[model samples]
Target: MSMLGTKWKLHGNGKTIRPGHVVAPEERLAWPLTIGIGMQHVVAMFGATFLVPIITGMPPATTLLFSGIGTLLFLVITKGRVPSYLGSSFAFIAPILASQQQFGVPGALGGVVLAGVVLALVGAVVQKFGAEWINRTMPPIVTGAIVALIGLNLAPAAKANFDKAPVTALATLVTIILVSVLFRGILGRLSILAGVVVGYFTAMARGEVDYSKMDAASWIGLPHFQTPEFHLGVVGLFVPVVLVLVAENVGHVKSVAAMTGRNLDDVSGRALMADGVATVLAGFGGGSGTTTYAENIGVMAATKVYSTAAYWVAGIFAILLSFSPKFGELIATVPAGVLGGAATMLYGMIGVLGVKIWVQNKVNFSNPINLTTAAVALIIGIADYTWTIGELKFTGIALGSAAALVVYHGMKGLARWRGTVAEPETETAGLPPAVKSAMNSAAKRSGKKP
Candidate 1:
């Protein structure tokens, strides 16, 4: 393989591939087919990537530009061993809003840069040592608490947007639900995007969309760019995001490894470092923080093509698209109602994912440490608790994340002191109906047996 693995031989004469066979990362189809797949990658990533900037009041073109750049950077840093596309991270939504209030967008960017540096450092540590310590530090219970709380805390914001145009939001949500059920495979996976499109049309019908801002944008021009400013105050808002990024990257590596039937544990650290660097680049260049996008993963899963060559084409396409300010402006025209509709499902899904993590890991609620850790954190997060010191402040997500870690560790240590820890029960019958419902709902959405 070459340095960036840009050299790829033909995969089966660049024609139809047999079932149960896939084009490896180092192999690609003929020029036209590969280009088509690459464009498909762009469409797959379009909705979720643009939503981050639209929601956070950042320039959509700028974010797209960095995403393209980040994907290329990831390929280079990982030495093309891993196949992934970088996109804006949803974990930054709440924190960016919080930091923007006090320190503005630049301040939020500062936090992003710092978080990337921290993640990169963790990656270096993992590369030198191993990833076992990460599991020890953030066990399933603790990680679940943090992830769930972050989502639950955003409920109020979702409601606020939903209130802006309740009818439109409702229609959007309904469309999303229907689309997921009506279509199978790739379309079902893209329910969010489908819903957004339906909602946009709904908003238009309601005469709520404003088209004036888009007229000024040119077809060919540079995207709006801004510089990050240092802000020690918002550091707390973004550091927890590094953990989420770590989980996402690790999961990406694991997923690719599973599909490719390759041992990717060796490059896990490099994967993390690559995403960290991508995020750092985004922060400095006025874009949302980047992460390995599941949307792209979904695309690869459907096509059974794990070609890095396709991703290279996708990156170039994204860069070219970013140069068109008119497209960026068009994206920005999405109404709050549509965003609210998407967020309602998206945020809840994030929370449920945490619960899924618990279920998958068989995290024992019967255990006091696990129960207390989750209970306290959920309340603090759902209630939107706040704590302020002389100059530092902690809101729901920050406070909840900290509480989960401290409570889990404190109770575990005390249990050890008293020798009270015991085996966890694996019975699903003991779970609450709400939990079971949520889990089943999630299972259906992911196309797995519930």
Candidate 2:
């Protein structure tokens, strides 16, 4: 029961996952199946993680290595209570570039390190103060909108992939749907991974999978690395990103809580500090700042498996893979079309998970404050609004999350000042122990530990 403990008791039967049952963070499945799901998560986070470094003109290998390291670090810090994958954050891109001109790449990385320290400090505050105030400020409606907008904000990224090879994208998307419907047990749970396999081969047939890099890549090599050089000027450019990262981490906690029907609010601070620590490590060795990846969260939503053990596998495997250029190149061969199809499904799932938060919490949209909060925030996020002040940039998720809080509190406060009826909020119940009943049944039948 240790919050930071690594042990994951086996889930029911460790083979078949019955309907209405999800694998919890502290539980695990058979090694083979867990390994597959873990690999699926790696594939899920790969594209976006590498893109940050690639776009910022930093070495992609360095980012991958740190991200993998960060993922494992996050799992440990959260004490296995929360399941998440740490990946390169898009929020860092603009600021890192801005800092690059003034402070150079090393200094930009230093800013990342400092930002992580600030984030960790924020986590420490939440840890000391408790996270209830976070909930007070952001109720179900606001949190739900925050999660929904993050997913919707990536719609264009999905569409861009869809456009690359419509036929291939459709095939991949269709396969994901059909596999879930046609199969049960492990295959059903692995539908996304299955779709990826089918799509890869399908793309190969269409001459979309490029094998050139795979052939040229070496079997083993070290990912490029560099140390940070501190610069105070870079702070202005990067620290603002902490706001977006906080919103994302909080949204992730809420989403997981909603999906698992459990109250994960307790781990909010630890999750934040974990990312901060992970990012600090990334900065030390020239990697992109990390955040909990929505892409991997989408995979969990699809799989119904939230085992932190799988993340351990994914993280360790990523570290191993970072040294292999051939493997990196091979993943790159996965065409935009395959990614497009996956993005379409994964991103949309995340958006809906936000709405699910509303449904589960019974957020009364009939209240004008609630309705407007969702309305304004969703539009800002889905439209991918962008605003810049000096060297700082704020984009969809950051803006949308901020918008939800402002719109909700602003309207609610104004109504209260006017002595208007402030609508009452529905309470969120503690999530049922989703795996508990099944575990009891299996243990009773087998005379084993529950």
Candidate 3:
């Protein structure tokens, strides 16, 4: 038999069976092993699990419960094709908080739920128009700007937390830095976890840690599932926020595909669908919008483990933890100072990622229009404290993102009209094998063989 068709023989003439068939090496992991590594992903994303609730004024335990259930639903919807753990995204924090303060929690939740639906709509668009269309509409420059806005908008929250107890926050920050700098192996990989642990102990030593809540917590029971209430005013407030989540979902799809060496369709179409749908489910279950967790990507990158099944394991763990009031209390008890120090790193990383995207895309700086678009966008995004348009008010990072998208696209359009920038070419459609063969034959006949 040819090598291509051959199977290995073992035990003195019999071929031994190969382990994996169609699945990626990592994808074929057993349930136990998958769960083991999956738990690591959960741990990595734990901080952000309840952060959405805290920021948006929803109950923290309810958020945690839905996060777990939403993740599992996401996996089921995706048919377990992608190995991503879903969690509350930081991108919505600014808008949700603003909406909550302006409208109320129900209104914010409505917006978040609407955001999930928007993501689902984006997925349909991706299916119909194809990835190239998405690539064209929201190029690297646009995404970078949005990502920059996401981080910059979050600056106030981090600063507010840090200012509450600068000394304690600094101590936590020091611990995080020390672990990141000095640790190795699992210790280094879990530097965030270690920092939280160390900071918790340090605060305890200083008699600053509060354990009063732990005593009030029950030993076991399900989360308080909430029924959503509808309001037009709340829904309207969240509409823009939903639009932003759609952009974030696109980024998540891109990030997973880049990290996993898979095409977006090949990697996780169903998964993306699940991410959106599960988020809707989460909202109904009294939670916020869910997206693929970026922190878990860090764990996978470090361990070089890419098993989709591992996320299922993490999902199960999350579900169990959700029902445990003590677990909820523990997660809730993490000091804001600890969160602040980490946020300094986490939020800044978002900005740095934006810079990376901008630099790598080689954004056309030579063109005055390009320069103006980028400069204005950055200025508006980073320092947007006020704007009023004939009565309607707009400010902060959302304004910045909206401005960047409009300005960049408008400039590009103007440049096209003036014949300064060439018109964009349509991406080539798929070519079947027979068509390829026919084209090749015609080319050979014309002495232009390829």
Candidate 4:
């Protein structure tokens, strides 16, 4: 059992454990372990976390500062039920770039704040209907398709970076793979961190890194905070950014639930609210929007530790780190090629995780709607196609996801109206004996009957 799973113990004999009777441990995380695990969370999110500012032309330090503030606020709003480790959200990168080109930096932040509002609204909707509705409305087909779309949609942008900086990118990639595949124990766990370290040093030796500001910087100071100013000109751009971020928030919450062996219902709404509140706070702190990071979940799962306090420690350290201009400069100088190389595996893992989710959920595909929905979603999302309707231009995973939702549910609604699509037994019949056994075992472990 994972640490969190172990903490949630069934009081009676395991065979007859009743729902709502499980006991939670007094502490989800221990001390030294907490700081260490928190560091792991920090390292996991470092790469993509700073990318938002780099792309949007905001200071990297501002990104770090906001991420820390946002993360702390998210924890408070969620009543500390979720971890707080603020970082950059990739979902907002493209939109921030678009908004910047269209309306400048302030306009971009305005959009980001609006995106935060959209997330909060989504949370409100989820709260009203309840999480089971989200599951029922999403189903495996819809969520799975969206998950797949998430990675597929980003592939082209990654490839463009790779093409622009092949050698540096390859070095970063090789280092990441080396650490992941060749290293062991703590080293293995920190493969991405180690790879970035090695790649950064390598770049520095080649004069690719510029760290002249290290000597001119103060060791400690308060971060420069900027307030957000909104305008109507960029509302459209910001709204979509927020919608896409909401989709990402859904995925992140689901991932954490899977990691903790809890139902998605346990934390989805609270987590969404946390991310939304974090973004609002981040705006006040003069930083970018924040979201839950799946990487930290991976660390928690591996360490079997789930301590909000540990995340608090990590959050404090992040805030401290954010105040140093020299530190931000160092983080900024990391070779983009190295980032691209590391991203190849990182992004690919995200795609694979989507497939794993579908497998875990035992999504039925025999039905025409199920197969068609997943298939079309993967194609359109991965291929990066878009269409505009009136003032809205929908494309990428956002478009693919919207399309899948429409096709699957709309067809089902139509069937109810005209009697066509029906649930079929064979939709789930293809799983081999081994997979069924594994899934059944998982269900048992999770205290659920198959």
Number of the top-ranking candidate, with TM-score as the measure: 1
The better-scoring model by TM-score among 3 and 4 is 3
Q: Report, for every candidate in turn, its global Cα lDDT versus the true structure.
A: 0.87, 0.79, 0.64, 0.65
RMSD of each: 6.4, 10.4, 8.7, 7.8
Using TM-score, rank the candidates from best to worst: 1, 3, 4, 2
The local lDDT score (0 to 100) that residue 271 gets in candidate 4 is 67
Which ranges of candidate 4 are over 4 A from the true structure? 1-37, 51-57, 184-186, 212-218, 221-267, 284-286, 386-392, 422-427, 430-450
lDDT of 3 by residue, 4-77 (tens): 21121222111222433222323434445555777887888776666566545566667777777777776555
Instruction: Give the worst 10-residue stretch by lDDT in candidate 4.
Output: 20-29
lDDT of 1 by residue, 342-362 (tens): 999988988998898899888
TM-scores of all candidate predictions against the true structure: 0.93, 0.70, 0.80, 0.77
Q: How far is 92's C-alpha from truth in model 3 (Å)?
A: 1.5
Candidate 3 stretches greater than 4 Å from native: 1-27, 55-57, 184-186, 229-261, 266-269, 386-393, 420-450
Model 1 clashing residue pairs (backbone): none
In candidate 1, position 404 carries an lDDT of: 90
lDDT of 2 by residue, 213-263 (tens): 689889899876889998656655566567667768987888888888888
Candidate 2, residue 54: the lDDT equals 51
Point to the candidate with the largest lDDT.
Answer: 1
- Model 1 gets an lDDT of 0.87
